[model samples]
Target: MKDDDTRIKFDSEEELIDYYCSKPHPKAFTPSIVIVMLLCSLVGGIIGMELIVKFGLSTNSSIIGALIAVIVGMLPMKFARKFRNIHTQNLVETAISCATFGAGNVLMVCVSIIWVFNKPEMCTGILIGGVIAFVVDITMMYWLFDTPLMGADEAWPIGIATAETILAAAEMGKKAKLLIGGIAGGIIGTWLGLPMDIIGVCGLGNIFALTAFCIGLIMNGYWPTWFGYSLGDYYVPQGVMVGAGMVGLIQAIILIVRKYKGRSKTETPKEELKTADSTFIEPEESELTVEQENELLGEKDEKTGHIYTRTTKQMTQTFVRGIILYIIGAVIMALIGGIAAEMSEGMLVVWVIYAMAAALISEILVGISAMHSGYFPAMATVIIFLVFGIFIGFPPHALAFLAGYTACTGPAFADMGYDLKAGWILRGRGRHVKFELEGRRQQYYAELFGAAVAVVLVFIFYRSYFLAGRIPPVASVYKATIDAGVNGTVLRQILLFAIVGAVLQLISGLKRQIGILFAAGLLITNPIAGVAGLIFLTFRYFIEKKFGDEGRKNLNVVSAGLIAGAALFSFCTNTFKLVSTNSKKG
Candidate 1:
């Protein structure tokens, strides 16, 4: 037999481990870890529901609670790190992260509904319904599917989790059981095992696990059949459907043109040297050491000095550039918020336009700048939500916000997919693997399930409370605020400024015009108070642009600090108000 050492061309054992550790593993978790993470998720869900009920679903409450949860959950892991082996550490960290995401998602849904309905008492019934559903689903899955698939590899855990949840619901003779099972399976599968597998390999593997889990749930009647294909019912208005179709046709034409050009080039055998351009580039390959190879092949990369690799300078540069674009995009959004506050009527139209424009501008900027990508765009979208909600007012219906969020997240998700692919390539994972497609499918199904569940609960609660004359004052209070007008002039000015800024950006080729637009918009809204905004914008531009590399870095950090500080202040102030109100009532 050929020598084992000579058979594999690895630089070192450490290299083999490192490479293997970076690739996706089909079976990354033991049964115990899965159980623990699922339990953590249940706990997180309970805590999240309690907070949502107590605090109401205001922006401040959501942010503060999420922040606290993340900090508390992560801090313990740092100390426990010393005792953990590599796999254990990954499992623990991944579990925490998954739990955090799940908790936030649950909290947001509850709070969003309350905000929409403006009812505090309604929270009790909905909370009870949601929790009962979740618990029942989890219990059923654990008893049936989880036990049988305790040591199953590949997609079996997901299949079992999903199957058991569905089967349990069927046995109970409850349609809601299907929903509960799906949600429970999704949360446990993605948050616990999926993350470990993805992180253990190159993050790309998570997509597969997530996909399998979602598919399993769907097969068990946990997901809606229409799913993402229901775009027409949700998004497209009858009148505008034709226009949307035209846009798709145009895009298809462009795609065909590109494809035809490529085919022509390939058909024409070029004897001449082809210059590197956007259309063509040399194939780049990454050379991995023995540890990296081993990791890709489903081994572990011990944190030896020789095994671990530092993040590349190019990646650092990309991150920095992305951050800069994100900040600029945020400032623009803030200005829009101020303007939207000024609009008296047709606010929805104005809001929709602003959202669409912001999405387009952010995408264009990120696309033009090679260093930046979807990360900055995602940040901008979230900032836009914050600015609009606080300065103008949160949207009455979740649909509008959901539409904008979907638009923004689409590109961001694509960017994340590409980033994972890069990691997979670097770690020597299979090239043919289509994990992102699976992730997308999973997200679609999850959203469908969530929406369906929410709709049913909302209807039930509305009938039970409002139609039956047990209505609370929450809706009335919200309506009264809307009638009184919550700083409409500010929103109008912000919108005007964004329009002016966009026009200037298109015509003048001057990026500073954005700052000018913001300053002028704020000034128009409140002349005396707006000076501070002007000063800040001016100082930021001059200090950052004129200074050396160190100066630019300092300014960037300072700007980020300012945004973070303001957000923190707003959150604390809002929480204090809620507490004071509760105290007074008590």
Candidate 2:
């Protein structure tokens, strides 16, 4: 086995354990690390807000964050040495990532909905509600991650891309050159108006899912020309998401229930030993001494086939708690946003229930799509719920609150999953249970701190942007939809396609994620990207078939470089454009 700078090539499980036990991992949240995290958070938060408000998009900034940590580690100062630890870099990446979504996705989007609705007075209330929803969003994913429903084994292509970037930078060999070359290619490709990120994801994600997604994208682009009508004319994408999302949620519940039932039937008696004294079974290939091997032998967890730091039951409870919190937040938003004044008693009750359900359901749909293909249609998902709200006769003011609250959920949830997946890889893929859990907890804390910073920044600066009439452009779409109102014809069209969506999801099952990815692609109009994804998927299949896992792994590394380079280029160019525009205004 070849050893990398970031990880050791342990000879055996016993050796891996002994090595980790002897050398305590570096602390993730040292004072020095926090200072770096704060800087990255500020930069990422500002860039994310500017990009979203100016261009209607936000990039994953974790690659940029990891790059900053690497630069800091290279500084000659002794104090900067702490940044060299891969775990510390992971935390830094988490901070910037959390802040980016916290500001652009949650805080700005929420406040913009109210401002765009001409209800600027209610921005404060909506902002508070958004913060609460944001917290619940991250907490829900933190607990539910690694479960069968949102398993760590899923593609999570963005996370994998970020991890590979970090590893390449740290190791700095042939892989690093591949990454650099890929990054250059990505920048050049993107400059030519090609979708480099999609191509990159095609090399790393599920082939079947991406194929479906690319087909949907192609259909979306050419639907009017090919079929003599626009899909959005009848809300086809929204209808598909509605049907697929419901089925997807049901599938998740079924998975959890099945796992619980199977585990219940084969329950095991607890050993009379504590966690510290607990033993583990050794693999046959372990090259440990006879005494060491004997000492490590023990029974595995009969419930789960392997050791996990967190349990399934705990994740389920955490999800329930998150839903309850979202319900309470919805109530608060209704009372504070003056929604209570607009609706009757029965209607108010219905509104609250609908709001909470919309937020959670959108998160599930977005998460599934992102995990499968690194593409989440967050705004489109919210609009689906918005259509439903209009169908239920929600007044414009009430719909504003609904859109604002629900809009904050899905992006934050998906972003958190990406960051966590990156950390999971850096933490030895959960092989060291205690270490992985502790590292994850530290990452969570870093995210909270970053979110806190974003909230403060938005509170201070959001009004300036609104005054300049630079609110997120999506807010206008929501405002327009609320004004247009839903008609009987549109509602009928939605209902008709929903069944088709549900059937597709059911047939695909949870593993393929075809239905959700198809909906994701349909929600965004970009034919060139779809074409790029198809081409790369074909190329990736040929490489894997000819060269095997090693070739596949190398291809994934180059793909990561492509994604990172494209994202970095986008951020820099956008930031420059924003600054230049702001300076002229000043």
Worst 10 residues of 1 by lDDT: 145-154
Top candidate (lDDT): 2
Root-mean-square deviation of candidate 2:
5.5
Prediction 1 TM-score vs. true = 0.31
Provide the TM-score for each candidate, comma-separated: 0.31, 0.90
Superposed by TM-score, candidate 1 places the C-alpha of residue 262 at a distance from the truth, in angstroms, of 6.5
**lDDT agreement of model 1 with the native:** 0.30
The lowest-lDDT stretch of 10 consecutive residues in candidate 2 is: 291-300
Runs in model 1 with CA error above 4 Å?
1-19, 22-30, 46-95, 105-494, 500-586
Tens-digit lDDT track of model 2 for 167-248:
7766666777889998998899888888999999898888999998998899899899988999998889888878888888
Model 1 Cα lDDT, one tens digit per residue, 199-303: 111111122222222222232231135454421122111112122222322342353344345543422211121221121112212644443332222111122
- Candidate 1's error at 55, in angstroms? 7.5
